[model samples]
Target: MKQVPPEYYQKLEELQAIDFVIVELTLYLDTHPKDQDAVQQYNQFVHHRKKLKKEFEKLFGPLTNFGYSYSDYPWNWKDAPWPWQV
Candidate 1:
């Protein structure tokens, strides 16, 4: 199996963290929609997630369609042994 690039792993890790933040903020936003602090934090998490997603796509491939890539890159999401496959 090919090793994942360090940059790709780093970006993935960052993205995962951002994902959690987004989830948490989502819950917070549900009841605290008027809270400026939560809204600001949620927006910042979105920015970080977007940046990490771009970095991941650039280093590896597209994980989604939200401004990740312009060209039709190889879709490896399904052609895998899953993350733990050897």
Candidate 2:
């Protein structure tokens, strides 16, 4: 068994928090599509999400599956307990 580092969980939580904001922004855009500020914010969050995911994958293995993420072994996010379960 492998012992996961504490930072791994921290980064994962950060990613999840960003994802939640993105989702809320998505919903806002669906109704306020003409808001430029909202659009820019959404794009910024998206960029942050991409960068964070890449850093996380590099340190902790792939965070996704189906070839979307690269890893020396494989995307182990689905290997055991779900992120929420941890």
Candidate 3:
């Protein structure tokens, strides 16, 4: 199996954290969509997720082009090693 670099793992961990925040916010926002506090928190999660995803892509490869990496960047997400590969 291919080995993932320490930097990759670091970014992966951050991505996971952001994902968890997103999930939590999703549940919270379901009943509080109009709550400014929830909305701000949700926006913060999205912003952090984008940063983490960009770091992940730069260290490894893009997971999604939505805001991570540009299509012209070779789009190697499918070929990159998984987080737990080695």
Relative to the true structure, how large is the alpha-carbon lDDT of every model? 0.69, 0.83, 0.74
lDDT of 2 at 4: 81
lDDT of 3 by residue, 1-86 (tens): 56676877777777888899889989988988888988898998899887777666666765654663554345566677656563
Give the lDDT of residue 52 in candidate 3: 71
Which residue pairs collide, candidate 2? Answer: none
lDDT of 2 by residue, 1-86 (tens): 45688998999999999999999999999999999999999999999999999998778676777788765755356554435556
Give TM per candidate: 0.72, 0.83, 0.75
Q: For residues 10-80, what per-residue lDDT tens digits would candidate 1 score against the true structure? A: 66667778899899999989998999999999999898777767666555655755554543435555532
Candidate 3, superposed: residue stretches over 4 Å from native: 64-78, 84-86
lDDT of 1 at 74: 59
Q: RMSD to native for every prediction?
A: 3.7, 2.6, 2.9
Q: Candidate 1 overall Cα lDDT vs. reference?
A: 0.69
Query: Which residue pairs in model 1 clash with each other?
Result: none
After the best TM-score superposition of candidate 3, give how far the Cα of residue 83 lies from its true spot, in angstroms: 3.6
Q: What's the residue-level lDDT of 15 in candidate 1? A: 76
**Which consecutive 10 residues in model 2 have the weakest lDDT in total?**
73-82
